[model samples]
Target: MKQMSYMINQRYMKKLTCCFVCIFLLIGTVAAQDKEVKLKIVQTSDIHGNFYPRDFILQRDAVGSLARVYAFVQKERETYKDNLILLDNGDILQGQPTAYYYNYIDTVSPHVAAEMLNFMGYNAGNMGNHDVETGRAVFDRWAGDCHAPVLGANIIETATGKTHFPPYVTLERDGVRIVVLGMITPAIPVWLSENLWKGLRFDDMEETARKWMKIIREKERPDIVIGMFHAGQDALLMGGKYRENASLDVARNVPGFDIVLMGHDHARECKKVRNIAGDSVLVIDPASNGVVVSDIDITVTLRDGKVTDKKIDGVLTETGAYGVSDEFMKHFASQYATIQDFVSKKIGRFTETISTRPAYFGSSAFIDLIHTLQLNISGAEISLAAPLSYDTRIKEGDVYVYDMFNLYKYENMLYTMKLSGKEVHDALEMSYDLWTNRMTSPDDHILLFRDKPREGAADRAAFKNFSFNFDSAAGIIYTVDVTKPSGRKVTILSMADGTPFDMNKMYTVALNSYRGNGGGELLTKGAGIPQDELKERIVSSTDKDLRYYLMQYIEGKKVIEPRALGQWKFVPEEWAVPASKRDYEFLFGKVQE
Candidate 1:
């Protein structure tokens, strides 16, 4: 009987030991499931084709580039590995000669922009207004070539009522699901020509975000939702619909977004805004040119396959601190050589040196050259042009293709639009209102000076408004009286050929597409043309960008001289001359001898 009891006790002990082992195994599994997962999301916006450290236009070393960004991203990937998410917020199709060459010149090869993004392992990208400005063929081809998805939730097809690009992309890492919703600024129609964004309509950010958030929550049920917007943070009413910079508005009004990344205004911002549910959402922008990147680290705690808690930290990391990635440069060496060769080719020769500096105080050869091109190409009676660059100079010598970039800053096509002579006068009035100040005395500032420059402001900070909007006429002679008020400052004397200026007469005017499309409101606000009617006035438009035509024009001329038209000047020379000199010194820190 004692032997039987001993055997029974051993069996009981064995069963008890088995129970304890099972409990231990269960606890281990639970602990593993309840642990934390970390992810790093890096964003680059408004890179504007600064792929290399070298400035293709200036032929000098620049501080920011995708080469440097790649170096920084490489280091970050060492820690995050598969958990690292890389995204680009558009405007990649314009700016440098590299993008221009790939966009227009090289039609057969895979765009270098796409190749670079793929090589850098970008997870996704968003379309920018400028990308749309490249027209459907270029952007569509670029999107098709990229391995990662190009998302644009708010860009909808007009015909089908469907999103033009993929609305969002779902990414999974370490059992955590992330949803990235992309949207571009809805102000594309205001700044871009209709043909550039044909068959597509930009939707409001707030409405689109609300719709996408509901779909994502009900369908995707993602652990985290991110907003990748190619818009600004500020909320400004544009075109009587959605705000142009609606990133901040979407973050505050919409729910379920864990983070929002913004661009397009070229302003750096980093802050946390509370959503409708009172949850903290991080909004960040690294500004433009790849000088900085938005770096975000997210730690998510999960239990039983469900997220219990999350911690997010964001910062703007400067790429200037990092060196250019050697691998990145070596891989794209051939493309770089091609762009270099393209920009370096001699186009023609300049008889005299020209600078945008004189264009501000009075007429200058720099702007007149553009006016000459426009009038000659469009056969317009009046030419409206501005000093696109605030302070850029081209010396007297052989001119390369790169120098054309300095001559004309944007890829705007030349436009020939019809306007009444009175409308032209009013447009000049508004231009001068934005450009000059009402000077009571000669000592007062000639150019409108800002009371105080905004924090972290760069060039053009001293001025009250944008230098690009300071338009001056070349085909007509006029004088701006400083003593008069804003509306009464400009006085049109006669046409360039001394023909009597008639306010009732309708005249053909040559201008850039940007102004023609009501970019600066010069046509709509000053000229008093309704926004809808501006398109009807387009008499003709160039087949290519103004810069391309300017190059061809220069090449055809072989040897050209650029001189100011002397068609316009400031009146009351005593007050104007002294004020102009003072303002020039104040703006550029030196006076032209």
Candidate 2:
């Protein structure tokens, strides 16, 4: 009886031990399933091909570049490892000569923008209006060459009725899923020529965001949703017509987005916006030229394969503070050398030096040079041109290819449009209204000075409006009466050749494609032409960009002398002359002789 009892006890002890072991194993498995994940997301926007720490246009060493950004990103990667996500917010295919070189000059090779993005291991990128300005061939090739996806949820192909680029991209890290939806500003049609966008249609940001949010939540079921928008934070721009800068609008209206990244206006911002559901969403913009980047830290807690809690924080990291990466510089050294050679080639010669500073006060050789070219190239009776650069100088001597960049800042094509003589007068009235104030006394500012000057800002920042909108007309004689009001300030005297200026007749006017496309509302609002009717007025357009024609024109002339047309002047020289000098000193901090 004692032996039987001992055997039973031994068997029970063995079973109890097995049960304890099984419970411990189950506890270990549950503990492993519940985890905390930390991720770092870095974003670069409006880089504009600042690949090296050099300003190819100015031929000077500049602070912002992808080399500096690369260094900072690599340093962060050491801590985050595979948990790091890098993204670009578009406008990377314009601005610097580096982009122009690869975009048009080196047609056989892969785009430098794509090459650099791939080299930096970018997770995804979006399209910008300027990127679209590169036209179908260049941008399509760039999108194809990139290792990562180029996403634009609102850029739809008209024929297929589908997104031209991938709507979004998915990323996974340590069992966490992230979805990034990209959208460009719907204002492209308002600013860009239709041929540039061709068969693509831009949809409203709010509607696109709403559509993508539903799809992402229902299908992706991602742990986090991000918005990468090539737009500004301002919701009231253009009266929200096409929502040019709808980054804030989409964030406030869309429910599922946890974060939104913005660009296009070149303004730096970092803040949290409350959505319709009262949930806070982070929105950030790093501004332009790769000077800064958006850095975000995300902490996610998961239980039973579902996210229980999440915390997000974002800050702007100044790329200028970091040193340029030697590795990045070495890898693309050849391409950099080639671009340098291309820009250094001499195209023509200049007889005299000219500066755009005088453009704000009155007629300057700086702007007249462009006006001369446009009138000559397009055979237009009137030329409307603005000083694209607020203050840049092209010194006398041999003109290099890079000097053309200073001469003409944008890649706008030259356009000759038919405008009634009265329409031209109204346009000039609008331009001067934006450019100068209606002075009641000599003490009043001549230029439209801001009510409160921005401290330590560029000289142009002191103005009430962008200086690029300050258009002056050549090929016509006119006078601006400063004592009068906005509508009555401009007075048309006669044509530059002393022909009668008839308001009833239509005249050929030469302007950039930007203005022709109603970029600043000069044609639509001032000229009283319907937005849709502006296209009908186009008499002709150059095959290449204005800069190309300007270069060719200069080369043909060999040694060109640029002079102001002296066709227009400000009346009541007593009040105008002193005010002009005072305003020039106030803006430029230098007294005119």
lDDT tens string, model 1, 327-382? 99999999999999999999999999999989988888999999998999889999
Model 2 misplaced regions, further than 4 Å: 1-34, 236-241, 450-460, 591-593
- Name the lDDT value of residue 187 in candidate 2: 83
- Quote the lDDT for 317 in model 2: 89
What is residue 391's positional error in candidate 1, in angstroms?
A: 2.7
So what's the TM-score on candidate 1?
0.94
**TM per model?**
0.94, 0.94
What is the model-wide C-alpha lDDT for candidate 2? Answer: 0.89
lDDT of 2 by residue, 1-593 (tens): 99999999999999999999999999988876868999999999888878899999999997789999999999999999989999999999988889998888898999989999999999999999899988889999999999999999999999999999999999999889999999999888767788888999999999999998899988999999999999988674441267678899889988989999998877778999999999999999988787889999999989877899999999998887779999999999999999999999998899988889888878888899999999999999999998887778899999999999899988899999999999999999999999888888889988887886542234356888778888999999999988899789999999999989999999999999989988777787787888788899999999789999999999999998988778888878899998988888887777442
lDDT of each: 0.90, 0.89
